[model samples]
Target: MARDYNFWVYIVTNEHESVLYVGMTNDLARRISEHRAGEIPGFTADYRCTKLIYYEHCTDVQDAIAREKQLKKWSRSKKVALIASLNPRWKDLAPEILGE
Candidate 1:
């Protein structure tokens, strides 16, 4: 028997709900924590896109990366719709990741 790993494609937004960033990670919780802590430098850090509003899991890393690319190309409205479909309130899902 073997353990399987999951890859995640996620959308993170800023406080004002104006900016949306698409990303992929193997450890979603740790990655989100890095965003929150401002440890992962670059656009996400500069723009403060720390809210974990949307995510989809895939067993394949290539699938996750493809989904991330697809999301990055979508219009902001379409991205918002996608997030709202899963997280209507646009809640910070990082807390849920910690079982809070």
Candidate 2:
């Protein structure tokens, strides 16, 4: 039997850390790369929201999507608090994703 992979719900922030973007994907690394490369277009690309600050793993895509939507509905302060809970300094987690 093939191993099942996880889906991810992630939050990315702009350079100035003024904006937050929530998204869900099965391949977090590739999705982050696309965001970094400006391939996503619209809000993410335009806002330069390439810093991966927070992420949660889910076995189901629906769960990941639901989490993403829930996070999106949260206030900015709430989102920031959530990120801070996991990453106190809000460091860029892109390298962590790549095992750097």
Candidate 3:
């Protein structure tokens, strides 16, 4: 039997919630951890985007990537509205994902 895999389109923000980032990954938990640990370097690290605010699951990688691209193209206020729709308080969803 073939195993199942899930792809994700996610949003994360800095502690101040001033910087928002959009990304796609196969492993949400690991990816968020990388952002938090600053292990990947670059924008997430530079912006200190450690809070996993919103995420959507997709069964197809193409769909996830497309969603990520769409979100990336959205205006900042639009993105903020999207995030608020799912995460009103902009809570850190990392610990939940990490199973803490």
RMSD of each: 1.2, 1.4, 1.3
Model 3 TM-score is 0.94
lDDT of 3 at 42: 93
- The alpha-carbon lDDT assigned to residue 13 of candidate 3 equals 90
Ranking by lDDT: 2, 3, 1
Q: For candidate 2, give the lDDT of residue 25.
A: 94
Superior by lDDT: candidate 1 or candidate 2: 2
| lDDT, candidate 1, 1-100, per-residue tens | 8778799999998999888999999999999999999999999999999999999999988889889999999999999889889999998998999666
Q: Among all windows of ten consecutive residues in candidate 3, which has the lowest summed lDDT?
A: 1-10
lDDT for each residue of candidate 3 in 1-100, tens digit (9 for 90 to 100):
9777799999999989888899999999999989989998899999999999999999888888899999999999999998889889888889999999
Cα lDDT listed for each candidate: 0.91, 0.92, 0.92
- TM-score versus the correct structure, for each prediction: 0.94, 0.93, 0.94
Give lDDT tens digits, candidate 2, residues 1-100: 8777799999999999999999999999999999989999899999999999999999877788789999999999999899999999999999989777
| Candidate 3, residue 73: lDDT | 97
Question: Which portions of model 2 miss their true places by more than 4 Å?
Answer: 1-3
- TM-score, structure 2 vs. true: 0.93
Error of 1 at 56 (Å): 0.7
Displacement of residue 24 (Cα, Å) in model 2 is 0.4
